[model samples]
Target: MDINAYSARLHRDLYAAGQLGGEDALVLAEKMANALDPSIRLVLLDAMVEAAGEITEGLAPGAVEVRLAGREVQFAVTPPAVAEPIQPGTAAPAVQPPAATGSEESEADGGTARLSLRLPERLKGRVEEAAGAAGLSVNAWLVRSIAQVLEAPTVQPPPAAPSTPSPTVKIVTGQHITGWVR
Candidate 1:
């Protein structure tokens, strides 16, 4: 990843905030931004390294490594090796009916339901990376994501307020005029 992009976004936000202080403050902010770029870049790199370490811990045999190569940041991730690697053309295991249980079956059923999911190698890598970043196990991340997608919106949007006429600008007799249109 290009660390410069993060630094640039930080610089833009800083300069925009400086606008609130007027021209003189903006000038000083610009100068400060230039000086802060290097330091901010290092901080961003450090954060990515820390996040990678956290992800690696949850992955066990799978690992995530953050490497800085000159101006760019690179991630090297190794997914956990499957005991039985599926072939390219082979179909994954089909879903099976839930097992029969005793009187306590309803309670167990309400707790956890398992599904066998098959993901391509590249996509699997990305999913692992995302899960690691969020500091969640792959199962938890998938469950949360699926729930979010399936759940209906709980909060309805507020009704829109009546629109008010916006201000307009006009040039009258070589003088600028600004006022509401109506």
Candidate 2:
């Protein structure tokens, strides 16, 4: 995308708005616009990066990344991999997969986002206890657990006929022998 165009448009708008203040404002506006050009472009790039993050989340296990060249913005998308579904009552592997080098590098350089989650009272207590046991904050523990799941193997059941029962997958959420059904 042509980021320069957007930067130019914003400069034009700001300069036009400054016209209300007369000749002195016009001169200052031109100077200010030139000074703010880089900042405006930075803001635009940040917004585009944020949009890419949202898209990536929606496509979990897939990714959409935005990169900035000298005067343009580029987007790279990695499509999700197709995998056979796991049968109901079966669990995904407990072993943690090797590090996702790409994700690790990006995550290390990125900032964190807020997530407001509402869990059942029982579940919340269990999560808190587990986090305590692991010597990490609840948020940290949750983040680690979610990361493990995403990095683990994917499991999706085949589609079922309308007249038949939908296939459900069972997952173990914690230490206990629990059946998290879907």
Please count the clashing residue pairs in each candidate, in the order shown. Answer: 0, 1
lDDT of each: 0.71, 0.71
Please give each candidate's TM-score.
0.46, 0.47
* CA lDDT, candidate 1, residue 53: 60
RMSD of each: 24.5, 19.3
Best by TM-score: 2
For model 1, the local distance difference test gives 0.71
TM-score of 1: 0.46
Query: Which digits, one per residue and each the tens of the lDDT, describe model 1 over residues 64-97?
Result: 7787899999998767544566789999777653
lDDT, residue 61, candidate 2: 51
* Candidate 2: residue 179 Cα off by (Å): 58
